[model samples]
Target: MRRPLAEQLPSTLVAALSSAFGVCLLETTGVLAQVLAADSVTGSSATVAALLQVVASVFIVIAVYVGSIVTANTFATIIAGRTRTIALYRLIGSSASDQRRAVAREGLVVGAVGSVIGAVLGTAITIGLVSVSVATGVVPSHPYSYLGPVIALPIVAVVLTTWLASWIGSRRVLQVSPMQATGGAVEKSLDEAAGGRGRSVVAVVFFALGGALLVLGMVIGLVSPLGVLVGVVGGLLSFTGLVLGSPLVMPVALRLTGRMFGRSAPARLAAENAVRYPERSSRTTIGLVIGVTLVTMFAVCVESYQVIITNAQRAQPEVYQGVDRTLTVTVVVFSVLMGFSALIAAVGMVNNLSMSVLQRTRELGLLRALGFTARQVRTMILAESAQLTVAAVLVGLVLGTFYGWAGAQSLLGSITGSPGIVLPAIPLALLAILAVAAAVLTLVASVAPSRRATRIAPVAALAVE
Candidate 1:
């Protein structure tokens, strides 16, 4: 039964699984690339090769972390909507453990299937890409030797990840009492779940700790690798603190945004809707927050490093000529990697928004029946999307830029003993552009769901579950 259901899972689940598979595939391929480089480089010392492998391994770990979080969140969203079904099983005399087992089994099945398919697809892609690169003289042709282990790693990693994600995701189903599930009260409103005052206190604690670490790191300066480590860790903690505290901040931000629209009905509706379910809205925006924050942080840090390097190059032009080239490569590589992570996160946002629209079908139908125009419905969605995007981008930019600056100060202090701050004008502009583009894209993603809502006859939509 679980196997059949797993086979018939929704497209969204399939998509999320595919993304997880892709991330694993990329990580495996990275390892392979490192191996190939190590083998082919004639003059490189063993230590250099070992360091390269370690770096690749570190990247793979990061990829796994990001991929797992996204997968878990996506799975949780899908499972949350199935409270009634789970309750039905309980009503039919299914034990809680039985239900849990069923869910775990289904997850295992999905993971096995998705991982196998992903491995095949990844192999094909890797072969094609490597073939093209070799043919174009961008890379030297080498006999691929690590193919077996390379393919095996992603398959194992992705399968385990998906299985874990699915199992943990289903735990929420267990939390819903049969009575609450049957009563259609399984899901709690954001305000209820967040417990405003308690959450605020927790948020404040996180902020204080993160801020203290960041300030301490700055004061200590980056005189050693440990200093760099402290700064990086501090920045990460601060970002986490911000995300955790977004719920406390969202209400005021939504109200301000609504006021900016000045009596527009759609804007007011959008803002109210967002505030009405703060938890849901925060979850939707959190993905964007993660993505934008990472991209901005990386960009700012790289640009700041460039500034410091440029200043140093002026004193020793010939010795630092290659430094600029290395910096350029570093920037490009990280930009692409972080950009991919951001794209995955954005997909999560789309899923969240789509689910939100779906859950509101009945409400939307009522609005339509009451003579609200389809255009107004669409406008409302766009307004909601724009508001979330604006809030996410603003928070992400501020946090990321500050972290980048802190990292730069650390690095500069380590290298030159004088920590001078330099703001990269062009990178800041680009960050703004990226933010706008993401907001526009999110608005565009809302179109399909909005159209579907408007197309359903009010009566028919109201009739739907």
Candidate 2:
């Protein structure tokens, strides 16, 4: 029955996507807020209202992009874990196309249901929040008449996103052969599956292009005034390059971290386990990379902007005070909006780690039989989580700092007449706090799976094949 398939599917992914969709739906109220405020302002021009509408639309697009990527990554992890199941179906004479269709159909069903629930929940929450704001006199009373269209947009967007993610996630399922399935080799080494030389070439090219673009953007800022926007674009390209090149980089990083803190048996084993399946580790960390990258990038850029404004305030204090306050508010709001993406990333990491642990039951059981304590097993899981968090945070910080420095030069150069790049003082303590939080969250998520893993007898686990 379909119930079995449903059970195998990741319910957490469904919930995360639903939450993301609900948040996106709630954002539509920004447009409504703008329209209402414009109507109430005695001297507000139609042009100003139209501009606010455009800004709201831009935010919506950004929300959709973040939501789609998170959904796709989560779904892909779930699909990848089922590689053996898909292959078994193929071995029993089920066509690859049929299996793919089944997966896609399941996605559609989940998407539809999740979208409806998200829409309803989002609407109710938004209404409640707005009512409180109105009562507190923080916002004037406004009619809730625009809720209908606002509710529809996220439902449509999420449904389409889920469908696309489902289709894309199934591509790997189709590539898995019956032989690989039977051999339990569905999760092959990245070098073997990706072709070592080809991957290297691609990585090198992307890294070079990204670096070149970043430098070029900085240079352009020295002469032309449009460097700020160019730098931002280049920063994005650079981060994308880093992500694409992670398969090559992850092993080196893992080895270094392992050697540094892997003196203990549990730490050593955890490090080895992570690098042994480099592709899986990379995939598991991609969501975290996306989330952390955005956070660091925004943080650095805002600090740079603050520096520029601080210098300007010395000359015309009153004239720039309003601009400074507006920028501050903008950064805070933007941070809150982007925090949702980070939340999704955390959820994905937890799900991926849990699935990975579950898949290694046989290995864990053998270690146990060989006298590995339950405490050791738990420590190993925590060690792996720590290593992943370190990698993600380090990458984010380095790239974000560079981008922020370039952006500052670009933005300030136009006004100051060829200013040098000034690196913003990043809050290392805050970043450390974030890294620790991520590690703790991942470790907590591992508890249940670790417990399940330890409960299986060695003989039973070894007999899983």
Candidate 3:
């Protein structure tokens, strides 16, 4: 039977939606900037109607990407699990190359469909928002202005990038071997198999490039304020690479530290798990770490902007003289959203860990039978989870600190706007926050799986095969 296009359609539409969101962000931000630059209420109000168009475009794009990723993640995992199905097809005469083509074709369809949908929806939204704004008498419109470049280019680009992103996301699926798909061979350690030795070279190169960019950013600060944005983005990437390379050096450090823990069983086991597969564990936690770190980071960036805006208002207090309260409210709302994103990521990590533990029921049962008590096993797994979350937190703290200081200096220097001098209390507050959240998340993640481990009967566990 031929594969139906509907099975692949959702993901393609999703890719397009994600792209639309990115474009909408750019457009809405531009409109907001324009509003901020305006001197009078009437002038600023004129752009309010246009903002609806930008918002509509943004949501359309977001819907497409979210849809695509959901579809892609689902299918990718399914394909990963359905090696037997593919192998049966091969046994019945489907060639290996044909299998690859089918999977790749599905990916292409997902990307293309998502892209087209996102573009169409985004364009329609932009038009609708503008139309609605005019009808509400918020702003008088003669004809649609700024429609071509902002609306048109984004739609086309989003459609194309959707396909590209989906393809990239699914590329790893095509590399699975037939025997593994057929369950002829058990899966091996992806991290342990991938040696982390040469990461130093990559880190060193990134650090060097980042440092060079920092200097350039300082130079550009005098010419255009955007240089600060450049510096922030570059520094952020460099810091990510450095932290990633931490595991390359982790085993050496952890081995020396583990000697002290050798006297205790739980400690020893925990230490071993922490350092044993640094590459793999680190790779697993990278996405969550980035998400978590962004919490403190977004806060820091907001503080920088708050300072800049505060200073600007101070000099021309009349500009925001009446709207000071309004500005503060908006800033607080943005900060809260950033914090929520981090909490959501923490929950996701916990769910992901629980799912992994559940899937290894047979392996865990055998470990239990081989002299490991339920308590010890639970302790060991929790310890491993703790180690990863703690490392991620520490790394995030370091990155946040760098971002805060660099962003502060950049904004102040580039724009000649400083809100006030920093207090010693801020670092203490941030550090305390990092420690508490890390501990809480670790304990919470371990709780569910720990309970499940104790619930299994040894005979039933052993009989899983």
Candidate 4:
């Protein structure tokens, strides 16, 4: 109960929003399908309805996947913050497994609470919208029950996934030595991170398998569009490997990006601080990476597909006349849906930044005691934020561009009358928008933390446990 609000709000918000998205998406899909099925005018309404359901399922899965990652990251940071307390517990009589299970239970409770609230909100909005649509004659009235057992699925999935994610995140508890109870908060150094060979091996295995699958997907594209499905699996597996190996990967990226700050004292300190704690910096930035990657991947996929469509239309103008409009609308709609996942990630970033600042009170105070000005301290912190954001966005753009190009080629190669390379179409406009949004997010998230860091007296902050 006494845990800081920052520690809990991110996970709760993620759970609630994720469940709400699931419920609303599923219910809305069913309603649309029902309406389409009732439209006796179109002979292919059933097929279209089926497609809608599949797309909705995919969107839901993406949401849950993003939510799970964010939840896990949030819990991992929280566990890091609780190092002192956990070490104390270990020093006395408690075992690591017991402590881990307790954290999982807390996750379960949070998931239940958030899920129920989201489910109720989603149900109400859905019911209200259906009633309005019916009354407005937009669709014919039908016997549709908003309350159904299906709603339970999102609720259950959220609860169970949260539990599982918490367990995964708390794996660090097993490594907390009772001797560390005397020490204050401590984040893993690069050397310590390098020693985790088990994770590195597993990550490499996943990467190898995913890389093989990606190649196979391209080969299969020569024959069928079904290669896109295989590509999706490959992308997921490869991305998982990247996340697992981030402890090793992110530090190098951070060091490279940190150089952009220059050779000033504050700049050097900011650069050093970011690479000083590999785990902390990686956790804080991975969410942004996920967000940017999704947005860019979708943008590249749509633009590349548009390119192919444009060529086809030029060849047969009559058949592809209105297809462009439909494509535009589809991209717009999916982008909005994907935005929710990005929003969840944004919340996680802000939450992690706040917690990082809180955990580093003593470090900041020590710097102050060493005669560092508040402005320099603030600049250092902000610089760290900017450095991480830049690194994450750069990585995301590279990954997303490749994935998007692969998806486009694998899915539409046969449509071009032969299997061939489809050059990726990068949308500069959309990329600019993403970059601007990320910059704003970093600035906004950094402000409060900087203020908090500067406000505390050196002695007072040093006294914090």
Give the clashing pairs for model 4.
none
lDDT (tens digit, per residue) of candidate 3 on 1-465: 245564343334335544444344344344333333442542354333443343344333433332333333334433433345566676677776776666666655655565556556545654555466557643244354333355554445544444444354334444555454445323323364346447667877777777677656655654444556666656755764555465564455445545543446766777776676564354434534554555666567566556666776677665445545335433543354355435434644554455445444555677787888888778776766666666666566666555554544454443333343332113356567767776787677676866685568766775542
Evaluated at residue 152, the lDDT of candidate 4 is: 70
Instruction: Give per-model TM-scores.
Output: 0.77, 0.79, 0.63, 0.85
Task: List, residue by residue over 1-465, the lDDT tens digit for candidate 4.
Answer: 245565677678767876776676567656665665555542254434544554555545655665566666776777777777777888898898888878788788878888888788767767777787678765568887666566677777887778887777677655868888887666778899889999999888887788778777767766666676677778878888989999888888999999998999998998988888788888888877887787778778878877776776677676445444345434544454456546655776677777777778888999999999889888888889989889998988998888787777777665533326767899998778877887888878887887887799999988766
lDDT of each: 0.62, 0.64, 0.52, 0.74
RMSD of each: 4.8, 4.5, 7.7, 3.8
Candidate 3, RMSD to the unseen true structure: 7.7
Name the weakest run of 10 consecutive residues (lDDT summed) in model 3.
Answer: 416-425
What's the true lDDT of residue 106 in model 3? 61
- Once fitted onto the true fold, the runs of candidate 1 whose alpha carbons sit more than 4 angstroms away are 1-61, 106-165, 182-186, 196-200, 218-221, 318-321, 369-371, 408-413, 416-426
Clashing pairs in 2: none
Estimate candidate 4's alpha-carbon lDDT, on a 0 to 1 scale. 0.74
Q: What value does the lDDT take at residue 293 in candidate 4?
A: 81
The TM-score of candidate 2 is 0.79
Q: Clash totals for all models, in order?
A: 0, 0, 14, 0
